[model samples]
Target: MEQQKLEKLLSKMTLDEKIGQLMQFAGHFYATNNNKDPVTGPDDLQVSSKSINYSGSVLGSAGAERNKEIQERYLAQSRMKIPLLFMADVINGFRTIFPIPLGLGASWDPMLVERAQTISAKEASSAGIHVTFAPMVDLVRDPRWGRVMESPGEDSFLNQEFAKASVRGFQGENLQADGERVAACVKHFVGYGAVEGGRDYNKVDLSERELRENYLPAFQAALEAGCELVMTAFNTIDSIPASGNQKLMREILRKEFDFDGVLISDYGAVEELIPHGVAADQKEAARKAMYAGVDIEMMSLCYENSLKELIGEGKVSVDLLDEAVLRILNLKNKLGLFENPYRGASIQKQNKYLFCPEHKEVAQEAAEKSCVLLKNNDVLPLRGGKIALIGPYADNPDILGEWSIFGKKEEAVTLKAGIAKHTSDYTYALGCPMYDRQETALTEAVNVARESTHIILALGEGSDRSGEGRSRSSITLPENQLELLRELKQIGKPITVVLFNGRPLDLMEVAELADGILEAWHPGSVGGTAIANLLFGKANPSGKLTMSFPRTTGQIPVYYNAYNTGRPLPEGSTERFYSRYIDTPNEPLYPFGFGLSYADFQYESLQLSANELKPGGSIDVQVLVKNQSDYSGEEIVQLYIRDLVGEVVRPVKELKAFQKVFIPANESKLVSFSITEEMLRYHHANLEFKSDPGEFKVLVGSSSTDLLSQSFYLK
Candidate 1:
């Protein structure tokens, strides 16, 4: 009965009012000096539809005072007085920033990631923003792609966990009742991570099985977490643009998965479909997108200009328009905007929440957790050594990384500043500039390394090198950065390389040359302090790699959970038929879920309660972990599986579960994982998600590539 009442109310809406709900535009406004493409419009200027004379949804511009004013203006002019929905690309922070998504994923603590999102929602909502285009759950492996920093790493299970965490954190209990929560938008919808050659906005091609097996899980998890909105991808899937793919948006997302929330297009994605060769023009693009399932056209005027005309010309059905409007209205009603749209537009709260001290403290903690220690030698923790800090990123503040929407860079502590805080026994030098190969600079770096008792070479692709619209064909230390490192190595100094990249890179040289290497992939806000904490032994580095670090660019699609080939490689054979690379080892520079710490940790044994189980049975798998060194640290105990034989051949190794255990020095801890029939499932050729009764070998250890195996069976 309530559903019918809501439907009746939606049905009575005028065409103009219904159309108004479909438009969204950028909201950011600043001085001409700071704004990107600022708009200069008259008092009553109408950019598109007469109904949306006052924008339907505001993006970057509306905040607090502006939000209340805009809502008032829209309400007064409209017949139904519908309130405007405000959105922003509040990816990491509204005012208080957290570490980038990739960094948070490295922590492998979903609860921490959840809290970060919860904090983000709190800050964003306090400032009048209702939706955040966040929890970008793309399963990205290539570190060359700049946006990889914004993803939850390369593993499917880890990504799925983080996806659920972010959704729960952002949405809380209910969109209507939770005033602190904001709607979460699972973004870049379908396979934005598979951009060709790791370049942003490139094409993606993968079999349906591969897509479902790997890439699709994160998005599906977000949907399952009740994410209220899904933003379409900029990339094409099977040559069809996602913004206009009925098979993806309608068939898969809406009908199959039952995502009842609004399907919003990425910025200018609807219009870009024409250039993508999927649509003829803006009108056709808008028509196809509307029919496909996109409820809101974000930052693209295609809907405002073409949808009404398309409906009149029979290019689109009124039913489709009505359906889209209903979805939008439902979201608005769910947000409680219909009850009182100006709920979040509080100037006092906005002012108080923006850059609050507590928010900064949480941001600092997030940055600390995201720092992954890729390699650590006994020489670290500085204790009290004469250290030389060298590199462009060492003193740089902009290295807070991409999507740092509101992070105050000027206030960000640099590596030099952070190290200075720890100890006064430090000198500074600018090694070869990032992405530069000047011989004089290289010589200067060598001189500095030779002079200091210990050297910390801060290096990486600059902040601009990775993120959206940024993709690299070759993800290596640019220019002579590696050459400079090699030169520094010749100086016979114990060197610690601190990386500040946005994506994964081929760090083979650093792996071999540097005594200690840290993969600090652009930790945001308190990033410097976090790295400093690890360097000075204030915090034990426990974060692991979310993505695999390839040894070479040729290994583009490398990941740990890959399918086994019929002609599997023998341990000591050099046979050509085997699935092996002739020139390079198939192994990566570092495997996914791989990390190192100052303290040594050992995995003792894997013990399972039972070796056999029934269809609906479950068992507890336990592993004994001991911290052998004198220092305390954390270890991520990863669990993988091999089905040996299946109806369909499976990956030689598939990551099943993992736990991050923190143990004090000389302490032994037992890590237990519960396995069930559901955990044994695999997607069949027909895409039914279920398990086949079979013998399974569970491998538990430090990283995906390294482990100890134990056998189990399900009958």
Candidate 2:
């Protein structure tokens, strides 16, 4: 189907049919005849079955047999026989679960992230999914928000790079390619990550400059990578909800960014405009969202009930309605759905692709790469010692994080099972429940620890504690788990802590109690196997933290790239008058790009090709990295820069580029990075993006806080 055919089909649609194309609902509404209870409708509104038959798309529907039935029923009723599109929230993986997005970000490998998405696309498309509301490119700095599990991390550059990789992974070279590919939808359009108090669906208030500087780059990166759709955020931007903000949707996204993709609202966001004090009724809500460039209403009744009335009263133009309908038709044509209504959906294909052996292999490799070693002593690599694995998460299979809607927990391997394959001289005990301390459980754990040579304490939040409407005010480990650690410390054995979580946690107490710590954040189905491999030296830990772990929860919004304040405190100063905390240090317990490997790495001898850079000229910065220990390993060499003087105040340090290299035992390798003028550009006070002529500092190191520095000038 071509553009001319799509336009011809659009011209033949009636007003009611066109309105139906813009409405989306769950598949259950049409799968069954009993509408006694409203299926996913707003509390005050009840959608008729007639509207379900005429709706253009369905959400949360899968399986080839089920989708084929619904499509046959819908096409028989639709006057134009337009096929219904299917969408779902395939965030990380569809059937074969991979590590959560946060864990994948810690790997610092965009190519691996892209490969995960490619597998995700293949599995989902075979199950009859056409679009996935995934690659959530929101930049999050707060760990209390449950949705942080879905984001990449705090840095703008890292999130921007992962955003492009996610788009290429999902959509591939073209959506109509032969492999399993679905259209990618970049979500939460503007500033949903900076909600006040780190609460979910809370109000977001920020300056225009702050919004452009930090939150908007990832979405821009997604659009530049050719994402086909955008989803509006649930929170308000500058006092106007994203679904009703004309300046944000029209000026910044449509005209400035030139994003001509279909814009859809977050779940039931259009109807909530009345409660937001921006609209008087459903009629007003539909009108405002349309004028703000929202092409489709998701799981809401405002558009179905009020759009026709608004058009009849001359309040809404027919041209605007046609424009929205045309975009939907054009996407359908692009997907080649007009020719093949089923779009390659078949039971044979679903069985052949979902949870296959090849998919499981990729999941295992991703789980291995995502494990980050935060601390280590000589107690690791338990080659011959008897081990004690004590915790509720030891034998539990609920390690899959939240938002994995289709994953089965029973299929996941347990930690006890993974370790049992390596050694038979291991004992297991359930120390306590995840959130509470039980006396009998602790007594048994102590007995097991007393008889063992080393203790591996596995601890973390429950699977339901993070992701989508599960925000927490405190990010510390549970008190009972800490108490368990305290009791186990009395046995006088080396303790290695393994954490299973969804977000960054304050580990001030855990760091003091344990000799070794590994952050294994919900490493999907093959999590236990990956942890076992890392524990026994079969694979070295190569992951680095993408988000900073604060020393305390009071330092809520902390990151590596923060602007320098005028009244900054001096280094190692404890002065009360300066900008320093009275009781705690002003730094994170674990900084961004911080991780430890079994092999020791040293950075030395920084050299620059030129001391000054002019227009159209590039400079090469080189550093030598060596593995001092007798074990081969991989290192992530990070490059950061700071503009000493600029038109606008810049951050203390900003990560510009990085390279992940492998070094043999006791061998040295030279890492080089090319610096161009494009990497130094920033948005000025007038919103113009350009670099200024000034002195800049170039820093090279393994982590943000520990660096070797040099100076150069940009002319």
Candidate 3:
């Protein structure tokens, strides 16, 4: 399918057919209803038989055989015989579920994350999925937002790196080349993660400088990596909905970033514009979306019903409609769907790829690396001791996080089952329900804890408590889980709390009650095995936290790299006039890049190759990391920089680069990082991106709070 052929096909399309190419709906719209009633879901978007016959694409449909049947039916009716493209929300995995994106972000291994996406692409393409709405590259700092689980973390640089990795992994080097690949759609285009009060679909208000500085970098990185599609956010940016903002879509994304990819609306966002008070009716909604550069209306009938009327009244131009349709045709041609309608979809390939043993091994490895040991008190590595596994998730298999549409919970191994393989001397007990207290369950849990030498208390939010539209005002453990912990503490046994959650929690109480805590954030299919290995000294935990765990819910947007205030509170100071909290400290309970290893690591002798750096020159900073304990483990050596004086106030510390290094027991390794002039650049008050001649401080350590510092000058 060449450009000339695509243009020729476009030239022959009728006005109705061209408009149909810009509409996407679910496959259920085309399904026959035995009652002969019109098919309707939660929304009032009616799908007529004519709309189904001419629809260009289908959403939320899988299975090679089923997709083939739908495509055949659609092509038989389409005047131009254009094949229907199948897309789904294949965020993490299709069948062989990997850890959630937040957990993968904790691994801090882009190459490993890329491999996981490659596996996701392989399984999804086999199941007849041509595109995935994934690699959500939103920079999140608020833990109250449930969608934070879908993001990488708080840093712009880390999110940018993972964004590029996801794009390369999904689309591969060449989309039309050999290997199982699906077109990647990097989503929530503009400041979706900065919703007011950390609520879903809330308003987002930020200056143009803040938008470009904090929000737009990761999206620009995704576009630079050659993502094929872009999805708009549901929220409003500066009082204008992102789906209908002409300046954001046309000027910044098109002219500035040069992204020529197809821009589609988030689920039913175009029709919701009327409620947003931006439009008076469906016809106005369709006009605004098309004029603002939204090429496709997802899960909505606004475009289907109003575009033709608007065009007839001379409100909308035929050329704008043709351009949108051309983008769709271009994407289909790029996917090679114009030639082979089936692409990589086949029942045979689905059987061979989905949940294969090799793919399972990668999931296991990812699960192992993603478990972060947040606190330890010499109570871990239950070697030859009778264990008590107690909680709702002790024997449950719903550990797979949200957005894993194709993964089966039954196939996932439970924690009790995995721990049983290590030792048969372990006992199990359901302490309580996920969110409620049960007296009989608590009594049985206490009896079991009294009979065991060590207790592994599994607790946290359920799978449905977080991710997309599941925001929480309080990010603490449930009262039942906390009460159970208090009751278990009186048994006088050493307890290790294993937390399975999607977002960072307020662990101040758990930090005091439990002897040890491990943040096992919704470890997927092989999660139980990975936890078992880490628990019984079979594997070492190396993951670091990407987001900050606050001391309380009041510190919603807490992160390590925050700007200094005019009146800053001194460390350990209780001055009332200074900027300090009376009830809680300004610092987080656990800082970003914070994690513990079985083997203790020590940082020593921070050295710099040069004391000064000139424009276009680089300086080498080196630090010696030693495994002080008699156990081998991996360490994430973090490098942070601070501009002591800047044209605009800078953060206290910003993570520039980090390296995950493996050190043998009682051995030392030298980790070196080259800092270039680009690393020192920042957006000035006037939005000028350049470096200033000033003194800079470099810090090297395992976490943001604990660091060894040195100074250098940038000239």
Candidate 4:
């Protein structure tokens, strides 16, 4: 009945109304060069304002009062009295901030991720936000890519689970029925993560097989989760930009996938097509983007100016205009905006839920689980030591990184504070600025490091250095910081390096110099407490790397799950054509699904209940994991599979399933994973998902690069 009403209303809408529906302008705010937008009101048109026309929707004008004011303006001033669809970049939080998505992924718990996003939606929707730009389901492989922190790591299956959970979390049971929930958008459709050289906004060129196999799964998973909106990528899929690629946005995303949701553009992505040289100008960029299926223009006025002229010149069809408007109206109707344009106007509720205690508790847990122990040499669990906490990030709260829109840095517990709470005597040195190259400052840092019993070197790229538009050609640690570490190592104290980077850095120096290294990738509000907990033996580090850490920027676009070339390497042979790199090893500094704990875990005795299985048959594969170390800690035992040969030439290995287990000192548990025929299936040459009857090797291990294996057969 609601669908019928939407259709009838859409059909009755005049060409101007349809065009108005298709057009979306930025709210009275702008993201400056620094990627931060200043808060503004609807009437504050000093920057640049639309002519009081109800262009289909508005973006970035969140908050209960702000959205209500915008809706009121739309209702009273517009010729057609249509309510505007309100959207905001509710990435991780609206009021209460959680750990970044990568940190949340470390928990390896989908339900937890869902709950966090659910809380985010509850807070966002209560504040008059009808839609959230969330579930950035880009399949990231490059750890150097700043936005890796925003994604659910590099695994397709894991990403699928998180994507689905996030959609359910955001939209709740149903948009129309759940008035407090907002519409969720799965973003950066089709290969935004595989940017060349791990640089943001770079090109992507992968075979179609790779795209369907690895890249597109999460996006499809989001759609399956009942997501009402899709945001196109800023990067190119093939030769064309994703925002303007009709084949991707129209032919595949719409025609083939049958996605009926409104396809919104990334922030200024439609306008960027002009700079991409595909579109001659902003007018052509707008025409191409709309024709390619972008329903809403985010932070770009190109659509508002170009759409009317394009339709008048017959450059764009009126039917497509109607379709775009209808989709927007359909989403608005589903969100119950027609019934209550100010549904989210609840200042009392916002005050209640924003930075709630329950949300902070969850954020702490997420932060704790997300702190990946990259390397430990019995230097951690710092129970009794005169520790020297040295770094610009040690006492600074701004190291919380980007997309933490609502997160108050002042509220963030600094590592210095957390350490002080845990230990009695500690000295903190500002050291060199995160990206600064000063040696005089390093002398003071070195003096402080030498005075302490142990030096805790907080290192890596600053928060401002690793987000979108903050891309760097060099991903190595700053020279001065590296020099400070080198000097600290000379002190001969047990040096523990705690990294507060937004993305993976080339930490070969710190990895070699530091006695212990903790990859604490900008864990959110409770990050300091979480790091302290892990350092003081209060909490175990169970977090794993979602993306591979590249040895160098040159060896980028690397992942554990990759296809074997025709010239396959024969084990134990150093042949030339067997898919080998002469200069560099075909491995990462740290592989995906990799992490460490204070305790050591030994995996032994791989047991399989059955060797052969059919489509419906099930097999139980078990491995005994013993905590050899004195410390009690948790370990995530990962399961992977490899088909020796296939019609499509499958990856050398693929992650199938995993289980995170906690073990007490000197205890063992038999971890088991059940496999069915569905788990073995994949897209064939015809792109159909089915498993072939063949021998398969099952690998069980702590990380992708370190595994123990056994064989099985599907018959």
364-425: candidate 2 lDDT, tens digit per residue: 88988888999998777666788999997888898888978877888887788899989999
What ordering of candidates by lDDT runs from best to worst? 3, 2, 1, 4
Candidate 3 clash pair list: none
Give the root-mean-square deviation of each candidate in angstroms: 3.2, 1.4, 1.3, 3.7
Candidate 4, residue 684: Cα displacement in angstroms equals 3.5
- lDDT for 439 (candidate 1): 74
Q: Relative to the unseen true structure, what is the C-alpha lDDT of residue 363 in candidate 1, on a scale of 0 to 100? A: 76
For model 1, give the 10-residue run with minimal summed lDDT.
29-38
Per-model TM-score, in order, reads 0.94, 0.98, 0.99, 0.92
Clash totals for all models, in order? Answer: 7, 0, 0, 0
Give the clashing residue pairs of candidate 4, or none. none
Whole-model Cα lDDT of every candidate shown, in order: 0.81, 0.89, 0.90, 0.81
| Rank ordering of all candidates by TM-score, starting from the highest | 3, 2, 1, 4
Backbone steric clashes in candidate 1, count: 7
- The digit string of per-residue lDDT tens for model 1 on 1-715 reads 1557668877788776777788876553211112223343333223533434434677765467777776776676677666788888777776677777888888898998888888888878877789888889898877777789899888888889999999999999988888888999998889998887888888999788878888888999999989999999998888899998889999999988899998899888888999988888878898888888999887766887787799889888889988888887788888888787886667788777777788777777787777888876777777676887888788888766778776678877788888888888887878777766777776777776777899998988877888887778888887667777777788888999999888888888888988888888777777788789889989888888888989999987798887788787888788788899999888788888888887788988789999986767788899999899899887888998888777777888888898877899999999999888887787787878888877899999998877888999988
lDDT per residue as tens, model 4, 129-151: 88888989898877767788788
Greater lDDT among 2 and 4 belongs to 2
- Which pairs of residues collide in candidate 1? 27-60, 27-61, 28-60, 28-61, 143-504, 146-466, 146-467
